[model samples]
Target: MNQRTFRTAAATGCALLVAAVGPACTGTAHAASPVGLATARVADAVRFPWLVGPVVVAHRGASRAAPENTLAAVDAAERQGFKWVENDVQQTRDGKLVVVHDGTLTRTTNVKRVFPQRAPWRVRDFTAAEIARLDAGSWFGKGFARERVPTLREFLRRMDEHDLRLLLEIKNPQLYPGIEARIVKELSAAGWLDRQHVRRRLVVQSFGANSVRTVHGLVPEVRTGFLGNPPLNALPSYARYVDQINPQLSKVDARYVAAVHRLRGAHGHRLDVFAWDVPLQNHLGIASTYGFDGVIV
Candidate 1:
């Protein structure tokens, strides 16, 4: 697979800054069956080497194959054997949580064609019904026109059905308050909020320390990741909450990973370091050489 080289620090910083500024489940009574494909079974089923290695995380599902943040793309990623699929979530004006990469639909949907007057509708400004009416897939290609933005609940249901795992990124912490609580409530409603055994399924990540801390408070057992530039000292406040610290591989080197490993809170659990968007091959080398936990690419 041809890999995209990491861009300069300036570009990465700009993207993350805008992203920081912007921006599932439920079940019937208990049964013998697991709510989200038994955690034990999932852990046992895919024993990702405790050893660090390139974890084939689908960047917004199988984004290269389909419009990102859609069920079709997620399914394609699962079918293709990606160990985990990642997605970004934002709150709609109606307070419904939806799977989307941006704070607005204009760039990915034919919103302009349909709502000519609302040429620049922000995702936060539109109600769920209005947002749903926008064509979310045709921009990717005509054949994908059937695709629609999915709700967190819908996405989790599908994930449970397919027995797929995820690396969810909380995109906008400031734009919407109580998102962490909402996320936990949604997962619990879908019957996945509480699990006995947890090491690596249903991971959540965010560049915002507040968001990461909120998720940690809501579901402490579930693993959480903090994404940012490194040296580890830059965000000392975050070191306490996240289970893992994820940074762009381009900014991190062997020494950087080592420094992150040394970070510790009053309790034990040293933060696992996960680098993002590395080409598949470089990912292997970093994991093997540095003893880092994984990469999200």
Candidate 2:
């Protein structure tokens, strides 16, 4: 079946299941394994209205089909019926927030050829205007030669148009100190923070715990996620501010998932566990088996 068709069927099935059972039944069911341990049943854990089942977040906006972190990729993801899409945000030399995955432009953009004098081609060294002059998608394929790196504002507008959720990551936080406040300011200026649905559709995440805390303080209504797995002992500290714990797939297990679910924070909210960088279709089952609340694919 085609992507759109498959997504429609999946949505229908999920709706029926939810109607028959309930949202609580959407979570994975555990059973005893041969190793004398419990294995979780494959079930939906993400409870958001836009998210129907075990969340399938499009990494860098369906990057497997189009150039990563470009408008083309975002369009591809929407076409494929992904409600949640992930992207990295970094500030340019002029302090403009642009969506790109790497600290350097060499891997995804034709930066070296455009600016031969700048050897390292770090993103922070170039202005947004200069970054826009380079082709971001041509490196992936010739058909996308016109694709350019989109500013955070532009990307957020596209997401709003499509009614898609965002898993926005603050990349290289140390390089851009106070980026959390800036992100909140931009979101507010775009009227995202004021809209109830828009706020629910947005999640701010970062590898830096301090950055996550900053976002929590600036926009308490918006959900914040921490990118890496801290020690089990540190989960309580994380629960104090973060709404979600996004750990690398390798770092999380059934026990870890249980521990995360058990954590309670201010306002009696339970912590959510989302696993990241799941690149293969086969691993989706593995992630669900481990009882991850969601997976970034």
Candidate 3:
């Protein structure tokens, strides 16, 4: 929907921040592989209210200003008055979680130059120490020379000090076995999973259904979103799994959106749909008008 039209439509309707994305779903009763989750049903969810106002989350830590996924990026995001900073995490060989977006180090780091022995295709196969040898920030520009791939702990410690909220994304779970569990462990250690008095605000999202399910199964308190394109796979089944569904906005048209808002839950309906990959400002403004809970570029 166009921004002006969306704004007008939003004004005319009782739009909730979180709406479902597709057709009517069976919700909990449809037969499918169980998410194996005990309901950590969100309380006071409707009371919390959809953030209709502009909420600028710096995608990959103010990536436009600083090197992505580095401390510099995060610091820049905080300085820019962005309360929420986004980043992606992957697992290392030793089961430590590290902040990075790409599967390989070739594009973001000078790994090819320093570790000539390592091929670009297989760099993720390296140990954390081996991965550390590459200069992650220099290519972004010399000012970020000290920036390196940060461990999850290091990032969390900095976030704790800054008191910034996080949009933590799990990138490519299938490649790294046990990564989901490791992430849970890390969050638990840092108290991100605590239901009471949450120290570090977080919203965990993943493209992998299994990864999202794993998070729901283990740490139900953390908000979860399943990221994907739509026409979506199943209305009833997928709806049952996530707290909210995040579909690429371009894929779904205006007609599909209203149906998503009607999605229900076990004790009644409790599903919300958010749109993603909103790279353009007009799209962000439009998504806000469309009643999306949050928009990510």
Using TM-score as the measure, which candidate wins?
2
Residues 105-215, candidate 3: write the lDDT tens digits: 887888888777767535357777877776777765565678888888888888777778887899999988778888889988887776542433777888998888787
lDDT of 1 by residue, 1-297 (tens): 122223233234324433222110001111122322232122212212221234557678755445678887777666656667888988998888989888778877777787778746778887778777877767655656888888898888877777777888988778989888888888788877656214546888898887888888867777788888644556466666777788887777777787877776313578777777664324455565665677665
Best by lDDT: 2
Query: In model 1, which runs have C-alpha deviations exceeding 4 angstroms?
Result: 1-52, 196-199, 234-236, 264-267, 289-291
Candidate 2, which ten residues in sequence have the lowest lDDT sum? 35-44
- Estimate TM-scores for all models: 0.77, 0.81, 0.76
* Rank list by TM-score: 2, 1, 3
Clash tally, candidates in order: 6, 0, 5
Worst 10 residues of 1 by lDDT: 22-31
- Candidate 1 positional error at 138, Å: 1.7
Q: Flag clash pairs in model 2.
A: none
Candidate 1 vs candidate 3: which has greater lDDT? 1
Give the candidate order by descending lDDT.
2, 1, 3
What is the TM-score of candidate 3? 0.76
